[model samples]
Target: MKTLYDVQQLLKKFNIYVYVGKRIWDIEVMALELDHLHQAQLITQDEFIQAKLVLTQQHRIEEQKNNGRDL
Candidate 1:
């Protein structure tokens, strides 16, 4: 997916929707869903890798923002 919203839309197509206040948690959930999709052959390895990279970058940014607030 090109964006988090795109990932969310993919999950929606599978009837999966989840949120728990934490942004990282949401990203982690998306990663898990992406893994499942990959294992099921619903998505390509390249898509999985790209989507994980996006989520990883976003997780890092969110973590940095949280750390900044703690300063």
Candidate 2:
């Protein structure tokens, strides 16, 4: 699971800059935008698959952490 610190490190590692959003990170919204581009043939399938994989993993981990059993 990604802690806030890990997320920060990931941003630095990827040289990513995210703008905050109303209910989600701007980066996430941008991802959907990218997906739309991919659907429109702007980005290659390989790039879209890679991004989808990474985002899926992150989301899965976050979901698991959020469902933790009470101690």
Candidate 3:
């Protein structure tokens, strides 16, 4: 998908919802859940890859924001 919300919607199709009270943590958990779904062959390779790319981008953005706050 093109955005984090798209990725979340993908996971939601499988009844997976993650919220760790932090954006970064939620993204991390979503990655883990995506991995599990991929390993189980529940999602297509293309889906997995696209979702991962979205998560990675969101994670990077979140990291940068958090880092900025610390400075």
RMSD of candidate 2 to the truth, in angstroms, is 6.3
lDDT of 2 by residue, 1-71 (tens): 23433433444444555567422344465466556667778656776666666665666665666568443
The lDDT for every candidate, in the order shown, is 0.84, 0.54, 0.96
Report the C-alpha lDDT of model 3 over 1-71, residue by residue, as the tens digit.
79999998999999999999999999999999999999999999999999999999999999999999999
Model 2: residue 53 alpha-carbon error in angstroms: 0.5
**RMSD of each candidate relative to the true structure:** 1.3, 6.3, 0.5
Q: Using lDDT as the measure, which candidate wins?
A: 3
Angstrom error of the Cα, residue 38, model 3: value is 0.1
Question: Which residue segments of model 3 deviate by more than 4 Å?
Answer: none
Ranking by TM-score: 3, 1, 2
Better of 2 and 3 by TM-score: 3
Clashes (N, CA, C under 3 Å) per candidate: 0, 0, 0
Alpha carbon lDDT at 34, candidate 3: 99
TM-score of 1: 0.84
Q: Tens digits of per-residue lDDT for model 1 on 1-71?
A: 67888778877887889697799888888888888988999977787787788888888999999899999
